[model samples]
Target: MRNFVVSFVIIFLGFTLAIVYHNNNKNNMVKAFAITLSLLKPTDDKSVILINSTIISDFFKKYPDLKKYKSDVSALYKNRNYKSIWYDRKGVIEFASLLYSKANLLNEEGIESNLAYKDKIDGIFGKKSTDKLSPTDTELQLSSLYIFYSKKVFQGIDTKKIRETGWFLPRKNLSYKNLLDSLLINPQLLSKNEKQLFGQYYKLREALKKYRLIEKNGDWNPITTDLLPKEYKLGDSSKTIGQIRQRLAVIGDLKQNSKSNLYDKELMAGVLNYKKRNSMKMDYSINSMLIQRMNTPIEKHIKAIIVNMERCRWIAPEMTKADEYIIINVPSFKLIFKRNSKKELDSDVFVGETMNETVIISSNVTQIVFSPYWNVPNSIIENELIPAISREKNYLEAHNMEWKNGKIRQKPGKKNALGLVKFIFPNADGIYLHDTPSKSLFQSEYRAYSHGCINMSKAKELALLLLKDNPDWPIERIDNAMKGEKETVCILKKKIPIHIVYFTAWANDSGEISFYNDVYERDSRLAELLISDDSK
Candidate 1:
């Protein structure tokens, strides 16, 4: 009986301990599950809320005022898989801060967009607010900001508006969504060196800043000379010479402010550099024209810089992708042949006059015609040739011109208007690059003497360079063809792309900025368009 009682008590104690342990384990598991569920639950705070397509649609519906950017916003969100891009668990990501700062400085980028809801953005960032924002408002506002920035920085004015401004250069079509994707991946792209604008645009912008600083410093004092001579040459001595030295120093043409009252060799060197930059006759003489150019107001220079930056926005970035290409800057009156983005040839070119401005377009040069006939356009025939023929009965024989097929044509000879060669790139404007017989005109300071075509100063050199690699056209054969009386046509194996552009201000490879006269009076028109729209 004693043994049975002891065994029964021990078994009861063991069963009770087992029950207690199982209950404790069950309670602990229930507590752990409750904590995990709390963590997984969506909260109004300390969590990034997703913005799906339906949410975006509802948000736009509530705020119909932002409907204009609905498509762009939707596209952006779709690209991001309907996730919160500008927010995190703490709200408003770091890039939002960077973007807001950049948008506020739009003017520095030559953009004129009035950032909408700028005050709200400033308030959001200024307070570093941790308060939960309505996800709808957050997504919409951030998307709007992205669109505004991309449009201003990546794409300039609308394509139609740019075309209306008479710029026909191929405009780069960019996808804002792609740009945003890049920024989301790497926010440091907001840096000036990594900006979305072209490399040349930034150089011009830097120049703009420098010029504005000069203007703010009251610019240079005007050059006033009591004894204004016909020309001031090297080794001249006068008070005007001192003023010239100071002026050159102010504009950075001279290394130091000599403060001398004599035109020494040092000052002459500065004058030569200045004249070269200004596309003037590079001589040691300082004339009235050069003085006038120097005295041009700093305000005008600033305007020119801003205007050309706008022009840069219209250029396609892919233009430099070609293996070989030609560029004719109309305002500079220069032609550049580039191979692998390196300048192969630079030539002086005479573009059309103001009344007959050269068309801004791109075409491919297909053929080179040596000793070509000039099929005079009807306008020139009726206006010039007929009148000349009436004045001189032997005008046709005297000028090596003849009447053929009821149209006037100049024969292929020394007296031909198109000297010894012509480059043909067929376009609707009836323009081509040709050599001119009146070479004296090229030496003039301003060479806008063409009727609507370009006159090349180094036509023979251009021909040799273009055909140097061709196995068929040797140097001797090219010369013989150019000297031949019959018209000889040689088609190129690879067509060279040519772009005729007009820029009143541009930067060189060394980032030196040059400003030219608005020879066609097109700056004012473009400026008017730019200023008229608050969003540019």
Candidate 2:
């Protein structure tokens, strides 16, 4: 009887265990079926639906217009495990709304690219409720919108296009996926601390708006004057003087118009300010050339501002992060050495002329050669030297030049074309910054006269500043090296980055706007690329 009871208990317990296992498996199958149904069919709570590659594929297939952004869209979704990035249980997220607004008003950012499917996005927002929302469609549209915004604001023109425009400066590498991740975490990134674009771009954008406003108000009247006087100085009186006062006041150079025909002390101050800003000789006397520049149409200034904004876009924000760097603005004919984000040295420079325009690039200054030899470029030897030698036998001797190793090089002296010292940032173009024999050229307002290299007016000062910390090269030694006939090369302890840029329009930290002459006529070429109607 005891054996029978034990067997009966064991069989009943085994049967109960099998029933519970079967029921658990059945419940799991039912739950899986419900999940598959939710994915296949739209659910009441959109967040419950699983976002997968198939849904994204179907979304793209339905909206073939956004096929151009396939790679960007794919990468964005793949990074998030095919989850809906722009949408949530409530509706489209805050960033979507902000991005849409920014895209619609791209002009405010000085961008010309048209946003794709902008009207469709508007219609989606126009709808009062999320009842008609298609999750897949919404996701794709937002993805496309993000790409459009990135291209215009962050990427600027394509790399190939910028190179074609003659901009060889190091292009900024932008990671839109990372930017999106940050935006997802904090939508306020769009408005604050957008470090992707260079800081100068924002400053130029603000100036652009102000200039556009001036244009909208029928622009200031052009200053018309007779060829009455050779020079207009302080205390001069004429009808033209009154027009100058009005022009200066309109452009914020003068405190008030005063409506007086006399060129008094206040007007003199305004004229000096204007001259300082416009790269003109900082004197009280006004000349016809200065007046002509002042009379440039507001439309042309607006165009210049737009062109420079494009340039600012190409510059990487990271370039400015360096503790020390050198910047040479070609159009401005100015070189600035910055340390710890402040101007350590600023000097007037001579750049290449229109035919031999200086290349826009960035490199590291590794060495400074004092009493440097001027290695005459083959092009120069063929074009100028050979012809000059033919005309005059003593040409080489007079210029202190000699032929060596099948190439012509000027001996290191006061008459050497490369001047007393040269800063070498080895590049393919054979360009460097050096001192010039003709110091008088620095006094001129227009100083674009070089053979693809930069000539610094204060070369000695720059050398001293660069070697200030080095015990091996003191100021006395630097002066002796520059004055000595023997060429001396000194390698820098730390390589300083040098950036050569061409900008016709720029705004200072104080919001003062300055316009420069397009010495190489590159503004129009760049403007054509930026403003052209072709869609990328």
Candidate 1 residue 439 C-alpha distance from true site, Å: 0.6
Across 1-536, the per-residue lDDT of candidate 1 in tens digits comes to 43565576566555655665677777755555565455454554322665777888887786676677789889877876666677776767888888888988887877666765555455666654545357657757877888877766766667887777667777776777777777878887765523456667778888888877777787577886645576888777888788889888877788898799888999989998888877888788888888888888787888888778887777766676689999898888889998887888998999888777788889899999999999999999998889989999999988888889999898898668888899999788999998988888878878898998999889999899889899899998998998849899999998999999888888776756777878888888777777875542
Deviating ranges (above 4 Å) for candidate 2: 1-50, 127-133, 192-194, 533-536
Instruction: Give lDDT tens digits, candidate 2, residues 235-323.
Output: 77888899998888878899788999998999999999988988889888887888888889888888898778777778888887899
TM-score (all chains, Cα) for each model: 0.88, 0.89
For candidate 2, give the lDDT of residue 315.
84
- Pairs that collide in candidate 1 are none
| Clash count list over all predictions | 0, 0
